[model samples]
Target: MISTYRAVVLTRNGGLDALELRELPLEAPGPGQVRLRVRATGVGFTDIIMRRGYHPDAPKLPFTPGYEVVGDVEAIGPGVTGFTPGQRVAALTVHGGYAESIIRDAGEFIPVPEGLDDAEVTALILNYVTAYQMIHRVARLRAGQSALVTGAGGGVGTALLQLLRVAGVQAYGVDSPPKAGLVRELGATFIDSRERPFDEAVRKRLPEGVDVAFDGIGGDSIARCTRAVRRGGRLISYGFTSAVGRHGGGDNVGGLSGLLALFVGTRLLGRRPSVYGITQLYQKDPSLLREDLSQLFTLLAERRIQPLIAHRLPLLAGRAGQELLERGGIRGKIILLRDVPKKT
Candidate 1:
């Protein structure tokens, strides 16, 4: 019965002003598709990168910018079975999630188990999956080994810390002093990036370096991480957040080209350097995403890991949420909800 829905549209890459909330016509699901009433969507540094025209995977201008969403199937198109009206589901939207309703291929969404909070489930879709894949599939780190995690208090960073503990890998987390307690509480040895260079501080404690290191800060942070790993160990560079701050956090950062250059530099040093993008990997193997996400859901249900949710903002507040994320110091994922559930 809804005739229109709201979504955040990125008119062009620039500052927070580029993000605009617009009402769009509602369209029924086409064959093989489902129309969902969105419950929650996640916003992170990636959204900031896209807003500043620095994410390689971002779509053309005048597009939505949400990466993941949890919703209820309000309508199902013909040829779609398995999903019924009112069924709860989640999807790795990649874009088009900052909305009240959206239509996408039914295959794009996976059923979300009941009793899990919508915001928490939204957090798992992107951040947790990225962390899970990097540690297990990419690094193949084993128990008793050691690793270092940079940006240890952000969404993916916190997820990485908790998962590293579950894998029984000793972890060293680098962050500002303000976040030391949160990092340490997650069972990681905290290294203050302010005391000195992180790699030097890490070497002071671990003379031989760790078994592996994960760097999402990119830029010069990548080189430091390469040194933090043992001679034969590996370094996985996933994001380029540090670049955002260099030009006032609003100017375009060179996207993947810059990140790749850093990786090549590290590789030239005889250390293994790898880069990861959740959307790129999911596009290649959709089933892998399903399998991994299902495992993460189980872990959440069993309370093996708790996702840190720093802020939950209203749907239309997408711009404000991204601004807060840009300011940094947020300890976890920021979720945008169509409507906040009232406390009982």
Candidate 2:
């Protein structure tokens, strides 16, 4: 077994510069854990937020910053079952995934089908799970209902569109013009987000407004989504991308306050439109996470859904990947690949 491996470490909270490639010590999995030789790790906007010290779940500095990983099990801890070395798997690390090897609780690792690409399954762990939970668990989105997604060209946005399509939900996606084709290709009607008054744009497309509006861009965007949602419709806010770097940087106080006020206003005014915030980290049920991931994996194995992977970079290029994601205009997930060590 290797004693050391390379990982993308976040030395401090800052921009892309904060991400550094470092050699980290490798250790065997303890009881109930398994060690994986990571093949691919997913880069996400959440990683950017964590690196910027904006996410409440951000780990202490001098730690790795990947949220998801796909790999082959190199070792299994004592008392572990249902897995053996050489089995392929994927996991949601929440952190500590940007490395050549990771030791995770066996319960956290989900077996991935043999034929699927590592990068593809890695994308499903965090992005797809978040989208799945929001669409099915939180919103309970039903067939034939219409849904609107802001930042529809992004990782979660695209995942939402794919799942919405499978669920037979008519979908509208708001993004910049460059992403129009991608949005349409993903089975969503594309509305240019650059257009002012996003709600009006949405209304122009759907006269009755949408049944559900998914907003990751927080701030006034939440209010706009509220307006775009029909009475009795729901608006789910999962991120504060719009509020980032505003109000003294990284703090989403303004956006949270806006969402809170909107929720209260809707309740008091009997508007019938409701707003809900989601943070997957706080979910109390581990079974839900596992179930959602299993469903996604089954869908993937059946070729029912395809995850859009924007780019694949070497493990060392994590910073560049983050910079690209931050610059925007990417249509899908960015994956980082690490070379597997040859068996000794």
Model 1 clashes, total count:
0
TM-score per candidate, chains pooled: 0.95, 0.92
Worst 10 contiguous positions by lDDT, candidate 1:
246-255
**Which candidate has the highest lDDT of all?**
1
Q: Which stretches of model 1 miss by more than 4 angstroms?
A: 246-261, 341-344
Pairs with backbone N, CA or C atoms under 3 Å apart (clashes), candidate 2: none
lDDT of each: 0.88, 0.82
